[model samples]
Structure formats: structure tokens, C-alpha cells
Target: MDKHFLIVSFLFCFIVAVTPLKCVTCHLRTRTDRCRRGFGSCIAQTFESCMSLKIFQDNILQLSYMVCQKFCRDLTFDFHNRTYVHKCCRYNYCNIEI
Candidate 1:
């Protein structure tokens, strides 16, 4: 009984640790700027690594805008959808796109 309880507790802790819970304070967007940059066309290019993460912690809007530019040269977007494709950058964009 003691061994079973210990194993169960360990499994429960492991499950909780591996689970990806959303950050209520810092929810990251799943959008990618590839489509905005003409990704399917000849002008399309890969996203820059330097712009992968936020440049300024305080200014999320500015950082996101700047990062979008690394993929799309045009920064004057009318809306978020116009600048980035929703839920497109969730995983392995470089490997899949290239």
C-alpha cells in the first residue's frame, strides 16, 4: 500500500509538471507574420531569430509590431489578422515552411 501511494503521487506530480497551463498574466499569441510577408510567394522569407522573443518587456505592442516587420517589411497593418496569420506559428514553422 505504501509503495502504491508513493508511485501514484510521483505520477501525479509528473503529469502536473509536464502539462502546459496558460499564463494568465502573460498569454502569448499564436500568430505568425509569414503570411503577411507573402510567405507563399517569391518575396516571402524566413523569420529572424533576433525577433523571435519580445525585445521590450513593457511595450508588448511595439515588440510584436517590430517582430512582425522582420518577416513583413510593411508595419502599417490595419489589424492583427492583417499583420499575422492566427495560430500559424504554434510549432516548427521553419522546418515545415522551408
Candidate 2:
């Protein structure tokens, strides 16, 4: 019985680990911190992760976006007088808090 329990536990862990991660999806979030478009949820594929992007103008937050992105990387770049920060994470809804 103990051996059977151990096998069951291992199987459960494996299943959970192999399952895809879920993430919050928001195309555009205004400065008011509210989602303005494409508000929903997404399931990340095996090679994807939850990503969050924040756009700042003059050091003030102007917009935010979240989604499940493939080959996502954490980075910061400046363009057109705005700074964009990209962060990636693994796990369910992790981007929501980024």
C-alpha cells in the first residue's frame, strides 16, 4: 500500500508539472490600472511564458500589457521618448503581479 501511494503521488506531481500554465491577457491597460482592451485569460504553451510589459513616458507609467508570450525575455528598451519594460515568468497568472 505504501508503494502504491508513492507511485500515485509521483504521478500526480508529474501531471501537474506537465500541465500548461495560465496567464492573464490584457492588450492595453490604461494609467488608471484598468484593462482597456482584449481583457481575458490565456494558456501558455510549452515554450511560452506569462509576460508583462509596462510603458513609461518621462518616468511615469503610461500603459501596461500582459499575455502569454513565446520565447519571452526580460528586457528594457527606449523608443520614441518612452521606455518599455518586459518581464517574463512561469506559473499561473504570474504576469498579473509583474
Candidate 3:
């Protein structure tokens, strides 16, 4: 029984240590000269990353979001008058910054 208990406890701790943490989430949209938004805590699944993005339109900050995302890589894109900035991380609330 003692051996069994030790094995189970170690396994539990290993699993918890290896798993990624939950993140905070939010969204914002800019209109003319102003932006409006809200934020909250969010849970992320295994194999997911916390993501944050800032969008610029015509060189002006226009929109932004924070989310628990499954994947992101080489993260930047631009088209026409819009630009997007992306950051991805695995720790809790890591998406809080742009």
C-alpha cells in the first residue's frame, strides 16, 4: 500500500507540473480615436498556448485580443491598411501583454 501511494502521488505531481496553465482573456476594438474592451480569466486545454494580438489599421491601433489558443507560430501579418502583432506562451496569464 505504501509503494502504491507513493507511485500515485508522484504521477499526480508530474502531470500537474507538465501541464500548461490557464490564462486571462480579453478583446478590444478601436473606433476613430478610442478603444473599448473587457477582460476575464480563462481556462486553456492541454497543448494550448495563451495568445495576445494587437491590430493596427492605417498605422493606428485598432483592435486587440487575448485568448487561449492551440497554436501560433512565426506570428505577424499585414495586408492593406491592417497589421497584426502576435505573441504566444504556455504559462498562466502569459497573454496579458501584447
TM-score, one value per model: 0.25, 0.89, 0.66
Q: What ordering of candidates by lDDT runs from best to worst?
A: 2, 3, 1
Clashing pairs in 1: none
Candidate 3 lDDT by residue in tens digits, 15-83: 998775888777664545233565676777866778888788887777778778786653889977689
Per-residue lDDT, model 2, residue 79, is 98
Worst 10 residues of 1 by lDDT: 21-30
Cα lDDT for residue 33, candidate 1: 29
By TM-score rank, best first, the candidates go 2, 3, 1
lDDT of each: 0.31, 0.96, 0.75
Clashes of each: 0, 0, 0
Which ranges in model 2 have alpha carbons more than 4 Å from their true place? Answer: none
For model 1, residues 1-98, the per-residue Cα lDDT tens digits are 99999999999999875543221111242244222332221112345221223323332333221122133222222353333322112122221231
Model 1 global lDDT (CA atoms, 0 to 1): 0.31
lDDT of 2 by residue, 32-95 (tens): 9999999999999878999999999999999999999999999999999999999999989999
Q: Which predicted model would earn the best lDDT? A: 2
Instruction: Give the distance in Å from residue 32's predicted Cα in candidate 2 to where it truly belongs.
Output: 0.3
